[model samples]
Target: MKLKELIFIATGLLVLTSCIRKEAPNQEADILRCILPAEILADKSIDYSLPFDTELKAYPIYIEVKGETNLSNLAPQFELSTGATIQPASGSYQDFTSPVYYTVTSESGTEHRPYAIIIRYKQTEQIPTDYHFEHVELYDNYYIFYEETDNDGRFTWASGNPGYALTGKASSPYDFPTTISPDGYIGHCAKLTTLLTGSLGEKVGKPIAAGNLFMGKFELLNALGDALSATKFGVPFYHRPTQLTGYFKYQSGPQFYEDGKYTSNKKDTFSIYALFYEKTNEMPFMDGHLPANHFESPNMVALAQLDKAQTIETEVWTYFEIPFDYTRYNLPVDTDKQQNGEYYLSIVFASSKDGDEFRGAPGSTLMIDEVKLIYE
Candidate 1:
């Protein structure tokens, strides 16, 4: 019984080993972190500061300096994905007046990703208060809304279209959550529609995308992994805004979905609000996560938000005005900090109020037009 039984056991063990699947090698080639040394931006005369750690996550990494700083020759440090390498090797001097492209290759050599580095001088420019929603342009295949400043600088509005593009469900500009609408109180308007994200989004636990427009930048790198933090809110503002006035038309979707499931008790609602906050080295800006509180933050000085009672479902163009409630923070606005561009203002519009949490109705729509900010 010994030899035959031993051979049978060995055969069974071999079969079991063969059935165990081998995991695939890591193929990600991404720049996880980037930093510029203080020596490169040292200036005693001008108020110069190093870039924030969070700003490195942008697609085209932007390094902002307070005053004129030499960017022709500089070195940068980068932390890449495990077993990945970047060419023009990290910590090497390169001209950054224009964008410098670096290519990263994966451990398996199956993936190659390109990253752009841009150096910009920090300048405070007050955005125009009036927003007529008349200008738009196409990028890649989707529409982008932008406004022209008095100084001829263009201010582009950010949306979740880029994140939705990852799902491969959008075939045209209209397929996106944000787009332009011909129907407006005047010539045209910004139309936001909550849309289904389909298979890929379902797999990632984000089944729907709410139509959103905001004064901020969308960090695409963090879109899929951490959507809440991907939306970097607020831009530098020099004026004191007292009120926000706008006209909108809203229609809720037939079915409400919460946490990716159908819910009969809830109805979809729209969101329109403005945030004014003091920017410091500690707290540069806010995000969808709202780390301090769900909607309140210690840094926030004032807020102008549309009340839920005022956001009724109406096909007609309805006018509404909200005043900035500065009572939240008893401290008065610091005139010195305001003049130094240490304050920021952000206006946000969304078809679904709880969209960032992946809860909304697919067909809910909110059309916004003629938005204006009244200054004190």
Candidate 2:
């Protein structure tokens, strides 16, 4: 039998023994005995971070019952109070860890149990500031330009568009093709991990500390507020003078992993960084925005004008954009397929000047999957 049931039987047996032994006056004393309340196994105090961008997150709390009982149909209830007022939980999960009091009543006696529970919120913070970045080479692969064959092939911009075609590798000659520009603008891989030469002449993979994801642009516009030039000038411009714009998304940095194990030691805080450049030495053409900061672009046409440069650190979840002024960085609306000159994309990781020193980057793999060239 369960502990509660066994206790009930034991209590009944004691009462029967007392009645048969009869010392009539002792009957009152025999029925009067102390009954302790059940014990809740879970701890009362808990600690945890709040969720990101949320009001309150929920978790489950556990309670266990034990010991002597009576009153046959005894029901268990929990009360919440701060020593001032008492209230009951709609249920355990209904109001987890809010304050609570547990009480059990029996025909023989009454027991009141006290308890405390801890509630934790998720981590919600603004984006970070400093970060280092690098760009993936667009020409790492190739694409087929065009061909005539079977009559069943339907061509969209994604499949090499109108008259010609290109494969990812063969199409490398053109920075951004018309087919991939609108929705699939630019694609490049950024590395969150880097190799560093230690003082002892050993090369080590140092993780990028803490930082946010960022994007920058270089716009080429005209006097009529129409579409103009951008990094991917291979595709023909529909408008005589169009505006160019660029976009990308970001998530928080990863936790530090050292020697393949996660360590809470102080040696593992890292950050990510990113920036945009016209050429290698020019001032950072576009700087990223932090979550705490306010950011908005005045025009939509400028996305195509940007050539992205990005980085990562210890932070996560940040997005940014740069506006193009036709007056500066005059971009070419037409093709720049001169393919002879080499363009550059550079990336680097900055250690926490005062952060963790773990052996590897916590979450240092950069993924650049989407590429697009927008016309609007």
Question: Against the hidden true structure, what lDDT does model 2 obtain?
Answer: 0.25
Q: Residue-wise lDDT of candidate 2 within 70-171, one digit each (tens)? A: 223223333322222212332323343342333322222332333332322321211112121122222124122221213543111111111111111223
lDDT tens string, model 1, 46-79? 2112122233432455667646567788788788
Model 2 stretches astray by more than 4 angstroms: 1-249, 255-322, 325-361, 364-369, 374-376
Say which candidate scores most in lDDT.
Answer: 1
Candidate 2 structure, TM-score to reference: 0.19
The lDDT of each candidate is: 0.83, 0.25
Which regions of candidate 1 fall more than 4 Å away from where they truly are?
1-27, 39-59, 82-85, 106-110, 221-226, 291-294
The TM-scores of all predictions, comma-separated, are 0.83, 0.19
